[model samples]
Target: MAFSAAESKLVSIFCQSVLYGVYVVLFTATTYTLLWGNKARRSVRRHNMLFVSFLIFVIATMHMATNFSRIVLAFIIHADAPGGPAAFFNELSNFTQMFGSTLYVFQTLLGDALVLYRSYLVWERKLWIVAFPCLLLLGSTATGIGILYAFDKVVPLADVFVVQLGHWITAFFSMTFTTNVICTSLVAYRIWTLNHRRKHGDSMRRHALRPALLLIVESGACYSATLLALLILYNVDSWFQYVVLDSVSPIVGIVFSVIMLRIASGVSTEEGETALLGESGVVNSGGGGVQLSVLDADPDQKTVAV
Candidate 1:
């Protein structure tokens, strides 16, 4: 059975609303924890995470609001049109739709950049390590902008499956997905390697690093998996892609907040605190000297102490 455009959009908005509700709950809990929870306060990364969380949430909220207004415009304002809501929805160049696309692209860029930044941090700020991913990020940015530009020049009632637009959209999705996968893998590998090399009396630190790696991979999977699904569905011209697309903004927030929440919770544990201190490697002897723990296998390798 062929799913009408209007039906697809309705389903998309419905799913988005449900997911946005969940996002709101998670965002609230995350913000509260970051602001007042004792566990979250001790994390060195708290402020940066909190700020990004708030920004993602605000963008998501605006996305949700834009979609809501789109529903109103399509169903009520255009009720008397020839084909009703379906016809209205077919107009790919609608202002609200364009704005929604802009929001999605912006959120996606932010999410990818966050992953890149974390990867850089985990890899000890090695520029060479992130060079390829940086190029991919640039590709994503360029292709994303190209998509919005194509949206403006497209016909009022045109669909997204057109040749030029489809190509740009596909490129954008592919680059962003690649960027995320690469960055996530790099961070996870670095942490795993460090965990494997820890010596005796480092069980606490091992425990801490293990969960950080796990949380990172798990959270990254959420976004990357959804994006892959969207990419495939879009290529297949499935109307169901609308549902996935609409839900992505909130998913972004969910993933971002969940990671911070888990990290904060983990850091609150005794093992995690000991691990953090160990990683910090501050010693107070008679001379008051400082000690730095080496994480890399090669002693001569210039690497930041994890």
Candidate 2:
């Protein structure tokens, strides 16, 4: 299982190269979204905004840590002579891996939160809609972590197998796909119901549904691609898996940035305003912000001061 000096150096270089590429793409996309999108300037739904931002930071940190580890590994592998520096690099790599695992948990949690938040928006007060998903995600994440800890410092084979399975179900495939599907279906159903109930041609209904549709489609595509990549990696060896999985974060980050930007840009039309805010004052519309009260309410009817 030992690599020759030249082979080790080559592998290290390749890993560093792939990691660097991921870092660059993710940083670029995140930076673009932050700069061009008015997410920071405008008010938004507290939960959605906070969760999305948190996810972005976690993904960024994960990539940075992975890249740093690869750089250290490269240095260790390519060192002309082995000494204190090699030992330091090895230790640093292990530290990065440990921290990376923790970040991965945060990443999964954030994704689940995003889905739960969407479900909350869709089925307001049907608390179970959000609660069930949150509970499932929490259980999945906890189980993954427990499995990894069960085989702590023991060559990582068991940990990797358990984690990879968890990722396939929770992180890469099921959570994203299934959640998006339910949310999208609910949003579409709401749209259809609104359209059917309207007396006249409701332009507003269409406008309001646009953003939700866009989000659903974009998220669906992104998750689908990520899942495909995961499937491909599952059939590959360790080296290929490392390269492919390492490439995933940057792509996910980019997709997130794009979706957030679209949200920040405001996808709803004037006709869609009513669709955005349900009869109950909750905004069922896409993206952040909730309507607590109708802006067009009669002033004379509600003169009571708060």
Candidate 3:
């Protein structure tokens, strides 16, 4: 059956509501992490935590503001009233759709940057490895801005219209999707490779932090899956696209915030702990990623004094 206008509105609102619910809960966790997790860390760690919290808060506030705008627009231009659908759609085409989506796009970009940074660190700060994602990020940013600009110039349409500027929108999301996939895969691979290098006791080493890598990998996977879903939904030419898009910022913020929170709380494996404590210099496995010790089959190379 074809989705009714009311049904489309409901889907967007319901998804928005649920995602905001996730945001509120994450903000609560973020508050706790800020209060307790930064107690003993170096100034840099504390500062980094503050920065992450600030970014996540910005994203949450932006999503909330955009949703409020939509609600107000819906009330003002009741789609079911006489000539209401035309007025409502025209307003959307002229303003609300682009404005609201711009906030969503920026939020996604911030999330993408976070993962890319992590991947860069994971790869021992290998500039060449991160070059492509950084370029894609820049392209995504430019295209997103272009889309917003185009949205304003286009005359309002009588019906919900997507196809005219759809290719540009698709390009932005595709770049975003690819960037997330690459970063997530690199970070996860680095962690898995680190663990795989050891024949045993990765579980027992600095037991407090062992779960951190797992958390990072799992969160990366979850967010990557969401990006893939959003890309697919966007291509479907339905209102359901926003259903996925609206939820994205909060999801990305929550996933990355949780990882940072855990890290702040000192949940790290031995190598991570080594990096955190400055025991060994920049082994990729240590989470420092600046200087990497060459891995070898020999026992001596494996035992580089930490």
The candidate that achieves the highest TM-score relative to the unseen native structure: 1
TM-score per model over all chains? 0.79, 0.54, 0.77
* lDDT (tens digit, per residue) of candidate 3 on 1-306: 856444565576777678778767876776676666543253255667677777777866777776666666665657566655435644544456666677787888888888888777767778899999999999999888877776776656533345656777788889988998888777776665664455434333544354454645433767888888877866776666656766787787778766665555444321222222212333343334323332222233334322
**With candidate 2 superimposed using the best TM-score fit, by how many Å does residue 6's alpha carbon deviate from the native?**
12
Error of 3 at 214 (Å): 2.7
Models sorted by lDDT, best on top: 1, 3, 2
Question: Which parts of model 2 are misplaced by more than 4 Å?
Answer: 1-42, 46-51, 78-93, 123-125, 150-153, 156-220, 235-239, 268-306
- lDDT of every model, 2 decimals: 0.74, 0.46, 0.64
Candidate 2: give its CA RMSD in angstroms: 9.8
Model 1 over residues 29-57: C-alpha lDDT tens digits? 88888878776786676798788988999
Best by lDDT: 1
Query: Model 1 off-target regions past 4 Å?
Result: 196-219, 268-306
Candidate 1 TM-score to native? 0.79
- Pull out the clashing pairs in model 2: 45-289, 204-271, 204-272, 208-272
Q: Which should have the higher lDDT, number 1 or number 2? A: 1
